[model samples]
Each structure stands twice: as C-alpha cells, then as structure tokens.
Target: MSANANTTTLWRPTGPVELDLVRALDRRAWPPRLPDQPIFYPVLNEDYAIRIARDWNVKHSGAGFVTRFEVDTAFLARYPVRQVGGETILELWVPAQELDEFNAHIVGRIEVVHEFR
Candidate 1:
C-alpha cells in the first residue's frame, strides 16, 4: 500500500464518547488508546456513526459525539472490518497498542459531525 493511503480513506469513531473526549480528539486528530479498552473502533459510514453517537452513546451517557477523519486504507487493511448487526453498519477493530500507529495513519483533522448532550 502507498504511504499516503490514509489521505484518501475516511473513518469515523463508533460509540458514545464524552464531549471533552471528542473535543480532545479533534485537537489531536487521533485518539489515545484507553486502558483496557483493547479495541479502537472506527466505522465505515456516516449513518452508523450518527446512530452510535446519537442513539447508543447519548442513550448510555447523556452525551455523544461523532468525528470524521481519514486514515491510511493500507494500514487499515491489516485489521478486519466487522459487522455487528448487519451489513449497513461496519467498523474496524484496531488493537490497543496499535492504536498509536493507527493514529499515525490519520490523514487530517477530525471534525465533529454531531453532538448530543
């Protein structure tokens, strides 16, 4: 894969995150691996991103946020894209230690698409 593959492919985080965490990720364009979280999830579509951030995340915590960004498709290829319920919703499960490398694969700034509180 090309070194710049991250520039062309898009990624979005899946799951509800705190407002502060969302803002922090936007500032850095990548997220640090949380302790014991084991997997870093990035979804394949806006619909899923919205669903998780709005429905699941907010329902669980009273706050949720979505961020869109680009990642190296090549690096992403190393991990499997999983389907939790059906084909419409898909996500990549990145290992924790590898999350840093995954962060490196990020191409640009992460922007918030939706926020709920």
Candidate 2:
C-alpha cells in the first residue's frame, strides 16, 4: 500500500483504563481525562501498547486493553511526537471538557484490539 500521511492510525491507551471507559471508547466515544490526568495519551505502536499492558497496567489494575481507531491524520499532524524513554508516544493535549470534539475527529469505530487480565 502507498504511504498515506492521512490514513487511519492505531492507538493504544497510555495506561490501564476502567472497563467502563473501555466500553465508551468501543463506541467511538473518547472519554475525558480523569481528575489527575491533564493530558490524553495514546501511543502509536502495538509494541508500546503491549509493554504498557504487560508491564504497567497489569501491575496496577490487573487488566489492560488496546484500542484501534482512526483519527484524522491531518489533525494529528499538527501535534508534536513526545518521546518518553525511547517510546514515541502521541499526546493529545485535550482537556476533560473537549472529549466530544476529540471523538468527532475519529473515523469509523474504536475497537478493542486486545485485553489483558
């Protein structure tokens, strides 16, 4: 396939999310950041996702999940990539109240790609 900068991208949760929130994402509804979470983070690769699910989320909450969704690549192109300890993570500087607009930019369905318990 040709490289398209505006194509759909795979994103994984930055941390273990509650099943309730997971369900919301599955319906293409991106939830607002929690009280202490100032930013909404989603990584660009599956490896990073797996590492988080296995190494962090599982340890914290005993469960983790991955979500596959499409955002307007053009919209995402405006943001800078944040490298956290060798991991290229995408940061959406979305405030809690703007989650609806965030979800509006997403194309198609948000799927649960993997789950760890």
Candidate 3:
C-alpha cells in the first residue's frame, strides 16, 4: 500500500522469537518488550535494518528478519531520530512503556521484507 503524506515508513531487524511474536499478533502490532529491553527501536532505513538483521540477529539467534511498516508521521515527531553510527544508521527510540501507543499509530500490517539464517 502507498503511504500517505501523514505516514512515515520504518524498518525493524528482528530475531526469530520476535518475528514469531509479531506473527502471533497477526502483524498488526509489536509485542511488549521484555523486562530487560527498555526501548523499541525502529530504524529509519532499509539498508541499516538489513545489516543488523544479517550481522547481529543472525549471529545471535540463528535467524533474522527485516520487517517494514508505516506509522503516523505526526505521532512519530515526538521522538527524535537517533544516529548511533554513520549518517544512515538512524532510528527512533520508543520507550517500552509506550509501545502500545506506538502500535496504535502503525498505518498498516508489518511485513517481512528480508530474511537471513
């Protein structure tokens, strides 16, 4: 589906367990973060998502997936884009306690765009 002007696309690099939880949610929402996970970070670019999925998730979980989704641009404006590395390595850090609200802003189903094992 085409994203409207009010929407912004985001990508997430996830491990198999997280992917399964997403699937369980029927792709409509992300599950609550684990106790140790304080933030839910969705990346700003597909390439960076791919790198993390392949390099980190795969190494740690034996499988990795890149999921793409769109969220309301206005709602996302509250979180500043955080650049953890290079210019392209950008993401929005949504507080774990706010994930349900974040999920409410998602524009469409989260889709698995790439996978590595």
Candidate 4:
C-alpha cells in the first residue's frame, strides 16, 4: 500500500512477493492527496480491497476461491486524472498464493470478489 509522500513513511515490504504485490496495487494508485490525511484515500482503497480479500481468504483460503479486483474502469476513464501520469493512489491485495504469479504478469485479474459455491 502507499501513503502521502509527506505523511507516509513510504514503508514497503521487500521481496519478490512484496514487490509484485506493490506493483499490482500501483495500477490503481490515487493521484490526488486528501487535504488533511496522508493515507485518506490510498489507505481506504487498500483497506477496502484487503477487507474483502481477507474475508474471501479466510472463507475459502483452502478452497482456492480468492479472486482479483481493480479500480472501476469507468471511474478511471471518466476521470483520467485519478491516475495522474500513471501514478497510483490505490493499493492492491491478493492471496499469498497468487503473489508469485503476479510478479511476471501485472496485467491480469487482480482480485476475485468471491468464488462461486
């Protein structure tokens, strides 16, 4: 996940797994900084994605029901500035199982909202 250049310590995990995870999230990074908080949007974005994923993971971690997600495409095309110069304010989330695969192909299904029963 990312934070404001000012308030965020810019802390990120290091490793093949972590690197891919960050890159995937980079695709949806928000460009505008909230007037007050450093992580106002990015954190919220990541949290939303993660919360959904965590739930899916716990419910289906062993069953392989986890899926990928990305920002609403219409939201991006309507306001291209949301992605300012390709800078992302969105954070991506995935099960550790798919982390390695993402390193090679960042452009693919990001998260599955849910798996079918």
Candidate number achieving the greatest lDDT relative to the actual structure: 3
lDDT of 4 by residue, 1-117 (tens): 212222221111122332244446663221222244233122224334344344543455422222333333322232122332234444433334433342333233333333322
Give the per-residue lDDT digits (tens) of candidate 1, residues 19-116. 46656666454556668678777777778888777777777777777777777667677878799888778888888778778777777667777776
Ranking by lDDT: 3, 1, 2, 4
Best-fitting candidate, scored by TM-score: 3
| TM-score leaderboard ranking | 3, 1, 2, 4
TM-score of each: 0.78, 0.78, 0.97, 0.22
Backbone clash count, each prediction separately = 2, 0, 0, 15
Model 3 scores a TM of: 0.97
Badly placed stretches (over 4 Å) of model 2 are: 1-5, 14-17, 87-98
Whole-model Cα lDDT per candidate?
A: 0.68, 0.66, 0.96, 0.32
For residue 7, give model 2's deviation from the true position in Å.
Answer: 3.0
Candidate 3 residue-wise lDDT at 97: 99
Cα lDDT tens digits, model 2, 1-117, are 113456557666534455567575566766776788676766677777777877777778888777677787776665567767674554445556666676788877777778877
**lDDT value for candidate 2?**
0.66
Q: What is the Å distance of residue 25 in model 3 from its true position?
A: 0.5
